[model samples]
Target: MDEQLHILTGSYALNALEGDERASFEQHALASEQTREEVRGLSAAAAMLAYGVEPVRPPQRVKDNVMAAIRNTRQVPAEAVVTDGAAGAAQRGHDGGVRPGAGADLRLGTGEGSGPEHGSAAGAGAGTDELGARRGRRSAGSGGSGRARPGGSRPGAVRALAAAAGVLLLAGAGLTGWALGQSTENNRLEQELAQAEQTQGAMLGILTSEDAKVATARMADGAVVSVAYAPSLNQGAVTAHGLPELPAGKTYELWLQHDDVMVPAGLMSGASAGSPMMALLEGQLSGATAVGITVEPAGGSPAPTTEPIMVQEL
Candidate 1:
């Protein structure tokens, strides 16, 4: 039930946690309903945020090149197998005193040299058979080792190429995600900047108006609420300092009062107990004679549900 774990809900919802940190948080979340609910809320928010961004598609050329390489690459052949019969034949040829190169002539002389009184035909036939067997075995064994076959190591090369292609694909995907995230962040910052500019403009109008009137009320705790109202522009800006923090599920809500009727204004930014904050009051201020502050539900109520903590006549 460590309170510090609550801060990780954002990162967890974003799937940014890794290894033991991820496991530990998940375990803690299962045991704590508050943490679990927070994680769910944050996750839903993250999902909505993702849906807000436009989708990005990778270029077709990257896919085309990877597929083309896979299709064009050749498969490596299995190594040849040598049999016991071929070994025996080679042994016999060596024992018969037949020179390796001279065994070639035995095939050509077999038919002419055959005769009933001579055994030359039998001798020539045996020599030719043994020589051919030896040649076949030699070719089989050297198919994987000798210079005549240059593709012996192609299997390793093909595997390496495929691995490289996989790495390239992953890198490209990562870069795409990074670019998309950055774009979303930039858009958010731009919107925030535009809003801040608008707020500044409104505040300046109220403070610089020729008919502007400023009012203030001080609380028992020494906190102060101030409002600047401009009759010419029908707008007012509320500023507060040293406002005490309320209990959970409660917030400070502002109101514009016209006679006995109160209109809902904006809520405070929930700053710390003794912090300063300023916000332009919502709605027109022409008929409103005063501004009031009250403690209400977390989100402000449509009508004031509590007594005014402070009221300043404008």
Candidate 2:
């Protein structure tokens, strides 16, 4: 068996597969009872995980202040199917399972409604028809090149799985086998969250430290972005001002460059070209000598597209 296939079972169980992969894996799973059972167990654990988090109200002025802040900014329009970060439900389409977008690419850790992704975002819609068509073909399907339609089996399956997971969780459902792996996956998610919290804490420390270094990247149009980093912790943040908002289908992607290779750092949320927003750095930054930002398509690119509009040496 392909090790990668085995690894994806957990993400699939969580309904985390990006568009193309999710359809392919479901087809493969239909033939393997082991895979099917694993999905069920993991789905149940996911339900329990959802119940574990405690919801807290945002600060009293948060909404008003945020809304006021964004009132001056223009909205960036997009056509991709975006998912709810936690619920994993597909954003419903106009038609019912009728037309799926070109392809459902999986973009994890993107902000929804707002962080290119925050926890996660999956392409949904046309999911029902896409899965159905792929199932009809009986082989790995091709890349989708159109838009999303009304229905998708995968999104429906996600809803069903969440429902089942909730039932299993509340009912103390026990399986003699496969339960441990499910719990382990839940633990893995918890660990990841804990690590993210730690990173945030580290970033806070770096930003506050007097030893931190700062650099500013100036755009041709008089936009100024200030970046601050701590070499000791390998973390940083960007603050943008006076920049022009991009048109539809374009985004600003940050990169950490070293050894002539560019590692993705972070994505800036949509804001008024002249409005101010700060985004923390993502990805590893060791040995990085400079940071840059570029324009790319909606979801982002595997690599930088051209000369960066903003570049500042560390």
Candidate 3:
């Protein structure tokens, strides 16, 4: 019992525990500030989880199902009064009489009458009255329909409908989250593709210009890297071949020598022994005197952290 009461903390925080369990947990929480604080923290976390996701509108099918449940379920009106038609008819005929002739017919308050108009045999006078009385007793407050009691409904069906509605809400939220995630990822990829296209266009302009100048450098490991510059356009492209692979968390970074300071250009792409990697220099090239390469950490650095592996004078 003690263990169960302790377990109610989470349910209490989410407002799921009710009746006796909720009352018990509230009493237990007042005995210890630590438990009270824990409940507060859990409650805040649950609220954050609910607010973190975007809300989605429920689908049409869910609305239809709920409406169908409401329409099928019978509700008792607060001041409704049911009238027993058979009992009313029997009372009206308290002075019993013989079954009337074929031409004689009578009805009171929409209740059946003992006559040939109702296909009653000549000998069914007392038998019909007894049957009517039995039906009236069986369905005293059922408006003489002789069916289930008025205002009764299938509680199990109502509960099942509620459970199904909860499931649909969860499913709708999951699908909405997935759709939002997909949209975000697609936007990122499209931006990257557009930037790549712009960079490729700039690099081609520099390399194909008539005023383009070329410079080459050789690394200690016999790798050849070159830069093509168009001074008129202030743009350039660096191409490297036969560069050896470095360990994880290391990269080749480029720098531009401007007067007395080394300005960071960008990180270089990896190259295999036979395949060449080309990259566009990030910034303007007209003021720089030379281009240099250095080995830096994975995401390059602002300042040169090591000596240049190769330097080519512009």
Candidate 4:
């Protein structure tokens, strides 16, 4: 029982055992009448402490503000009554209040006598009554309901507008992100295309140089094959070591084959004796498929009379 009392004290301080320990404590509290009484006492003490520590201060102009609010509320109904003197008198009688007469009492600036000030007050009160009556009529037309229209906005309208604005802001951000991604991808593709164009131009320059030499061959039979030639346009030049030599009266004629038609490449003179030759082939080898050496007559043939002796796939 003493331990249970201690637990209740700790709970009051918000420092008791937690989780399973608190759950067990609660179960024990429910089972024992004494523990429940202790817990209740501790709870009451805690509440007293909480309330004591809370700050309490009167609102500024609270009296005037409250009075003003009450006055405003009553003004509507009071003005309605003043609109009809007979009705006003009847209402006063129902409330057991004395009705003021036009010549009841005389006081300076107090609408009691038949003076100008009294007349002025009467006129002003009558105006207030007429205004209130109009407001009462309007209220009655609206079914005497004090609540605003279902869809009508109040102070919470600002919050709704803010929420709508936030959604639009999020949508705008998403569109901006997508647009940036597409722009980056387009830039990357443009760079690749430019690089490809540059590479093509470099290849074209290499295929059309004049200081190019070519190896040539001809068939034993005189063939009317003309040879047009260009040098082998390697970065530096290809070392032709271990190449085979040409036979006598049958010079090697180089020919570039394009799309099933053989274009003439220049002739090769002298016996290479199986040694590599330092020669470049001529003409545009941009899109050539194969290079062929055919045998031709002395001084070279206009075309090939016989088949090629050697051919290299380019």
| Candidate number achieving the greatest lDDT relative to the actual structure | 1
Q: What is the C-alpha lDDT of each candidate?
A: 0.47, 0.45, 0.46, 0.35
Ranking, lDDT, top scorer first: 1, 3, 2, 4
Question: Per-prediction TM-score, please?
Answer: 0.39, 0.36, 0.39, 0.24
Per-residue alpha-carbon lDDT of candidate 2 for residues 179-283, written as tens digits (9 for 90 to 100):
233223444443433333222223223332233466666678887677766543345666566667888888788898887988888677422344454555666
For 1-314, candidate 1 gives per-residue lDDT tens digits of 66776678787656576534543453344345466556534543454454577898879997887665444332222120001111122334445543332222112111344322111111111111122221122223323333222222322122211211111111111111112232244544434333332333344333323344666667898876667765544556677667776788998899989889999988865223544656667765667878888899998999999999888887
Give lDDT tens digits, candidate 4, residues 1-314.
Answer: 44743455445223334423432343333234455444333433333443456686778788767664443332223323322221233246555463532111111221234232111111111111122232122222333343221222221111111211111111111111112232244544434333222221211112112222322333345322212222222211112233355556766666777878887766654222643332224344657777776777766777777797666656
Winner on TM-score (1 vs 4): 1
The TM-score ranking, best first, is 1, 3, 2, 4
> Where in model 4 is the C-alpha error above 4 Å?
1-247, 270-274
Clashes (N, CA, C under 3 Å) per candidate: 0, 33, 0, 33
TM-score of candidate 3 relative to the true fold? 0.39
Candidate 1 versus the native: TM-score? 0.39
